[model samples]
Target chain A: MNSHLILRTVSKFLIPLIVVYGLYVHFHGDFGPGGGFQAGVIVAAAVVLYALIFGLDACKVAVPPSWIRIGMTTGVLLYVGTGVVTWLLGGAFLDYDVLRNNPDHPAGQHLGIILVELGVLFTVATVMVAIFYAFGSRTPDISDEDW
Target chain B: MLNLINAAAAQAGNVPPTLIIDICLMAMLVVVAFAIVRIRSLFAIVMLQGVYSLLSAAWFVSLDAVDVAFTESAVGAGISTVLMLSAMLLTDRKSAPVPVKKALGPLMVCVLAGAAMFYAIPDMPAFGDPDSPANTGPGMEYMTASVKQVEVPNVVTAVLASYRGYDTMAETVVIFMAGLGVLLLLGLNGNAGFWQAKVQGQNICTQAAPRARILTSPSDKPNTEPRAPGDPEPSSKNTSVKKVAAKKTAARKTAAKKPATKRTTSKKAAKKPAKPKGEAS
Candidate 1:
């Protein structure tokens, strides 16, 4: 696949753009349609596309599966940690209004939402990639001729 | 021309464009569903499922559920397709023949579920009705206050990440658990592990590069060593040989500089008939 000039060129061109779009969707989620889940899936799709074109070995080198596992754990921890922070601040669990000094301010909510969405993004993307890796790692039970 | 078109669209009324798009998408979805049900090939079914997701995504956009549409398009159409294809790589492409009697029970269950859903539909309020229980109550309060409270333009995100944060957190945990389940079931062999070791001539655990090279090189050229009497028939050997040859050609095309010894180990592994069958089952 590396030697396939057309595929290599097109994927090289497209992958960065897809990744950028994923980020854009993630950040702009507050103002628009997309958010963590959609952005995560889109980003995972970009990685999957890279794996498909460049082969799984090359992809593993680029984004190690161990890192993906860590990311999956970290995202959930981030989400839970945010809640714990809110609790420490003397608010109810996941109550963003009390995250900052002023309970009535919207700025705290904004910060809280961003952090939570980021957590969601990380977990969703890494979990998706992990699932892809799991499936790709297995050898086929049946041969192509059997198909 | 723009004015004329605008006038024509205005004359056609609010329903035409949305109705047309809705009908087209729904009709296509129905067709794809039928095609999926009728298809025997698992590969085609997977492709059709992707199409189904895309169609539903379009429908979600039409319904003004852009966030839902975005999620559907990315997760349903994109990631799911790739995941399913990866899964198919390890499994048979053809679905097994099913007896009518075996399928009947599931069919009845589906029909009953569908009927119950249909029975409940009329009792539900009309779509977007402001006075509806959903649109009134807390939902209306959220819509009114979310902008001022969350300061996010997209209410869905605000609600999902903040207002209903606990639910979203649980959902994230569910996804995390799902990934954990797959890892536990399949084992963490995604890296340069046993599968890649077979094809790439690199020991996953030991990282014994030189030994891998030696093992791979000899395995490539025809094994002059006498075969054991208990070995399987020559036909299986031929199939393994053909597969190795094909893999070699592919590797050569893509990675000319890579050592030819890479695929030989996999060929030898494939020849061990009992191992793969036992693992698969």
Candidate 2:
């Protein structure tokens, strides 16, 4: 098989698996060692690999810059929104127990963990992609004029 | 005394496997650092810099700082490498090889500082002592309590956003300033008319929107006349004729409006006779 086709086929299956593993690591952090940051990087790494094997242009077609910007903003908003919700419910910022009427329930911890992990994933993935664009993209003016 | 020194050497050689591996990695790091400095080729030096980041990530992993290791691998190995590559493309890829310079004053200062740090480490907590005063500090208490009370599983986020939120805000402001600086350097704000003139001339986006019809006729009318290279083509003449026809149509519409308005006033006067007779009846 050609390299591009092979990469396409592999990424089709690989990205979802990486995302699932990232979510597992994110949720399992309280019991195990891995957490939001690690999960975020893992998922971002998988996407970066996809970008590397395929051309940057093709990679961009798959996930455009606008979508990445939105994802990053959504992640930060989710984290902030959770805090605001807790604050509104008569608790300090990020106080998880205030998410529900029942303070003793473990559901708040679950909800808080999921939201923070999603935010971490969003920020890490977008920043990775943005930095990639910064260094990889060359203006035609700069590129055409050989230094 | 000779026997005692030999025995000590033998015991050192029998150090645990993990310690041996750590020593090996440290030695490799030293070799990489020396190579980075001594290498004459700029291209090779840039590649070695990326290698250095990967090695550092490995060290973090060995130290059980997985989060830090992941960040280093992604940012250092990935992002920094891309940045260095871009910089390399912008300039000449060769370095002038010079003999090693004399390192007298700064080298001595660095060595002395390193020695002082080594001396200070002995008074700090032993490798992994859980009950050490350093480990039992209020920071540790905060970390433990924050996990249960703050509700976020990621203590880093809690500490960064809630406990030390002001610092995060300041960092964000710095990032915003940097973005603004980049925009200023790129001249995005200068000569607002530059984009306006280009847009008005081309009308590319105007065609996409319904409201942009205001920009269509006048601008496109003159510009599209020269599209045909040869007048021998029948379609070219027909299109030019169509343009003339459109201008005639516009003139006729303007001409027709005044007469239509006058006709309406005359029609109203004619209708007054019918209205008066109906009122009399």
**Residue A107 lDDT (model 2):** 61
List clash counts for every candidate, in order: 0, 0
- Candidate 1 stretches greater than 4 Å from native: A102-104, A140-147, B1-15, B97-124, B190-281
Clashing pairs in 1: none
Q: Can you write out model 2's per-residue Cα lDDT over A39-113, one digit (the tens) per residue?
A: 666666666666566644455566665565576566667776777888898988776666656655546655665
lDDT of 1 at A9: 92
The number of the candidate with the highest TM-score is: 1
| Candidate 2 docking classification | incorrect
Least lDDT summed over 10 consecutive residues: which range in candidate 1 chain B? Answer: B209-218
Docking class of 1: acceptable
Compare the candidates by lDDT and give the number of the best one. Answer: 1
Model 1 lDDT tens row, B1-281: 64665565688886445666677789999999999988999989999999999999999998998888888889888988888887776557789876566688889999999999999999988767878987778988888889788889899998899889999999999999998988775644432222233437755442222121112222343333456989854565676576655654443343234332233333334332322222322
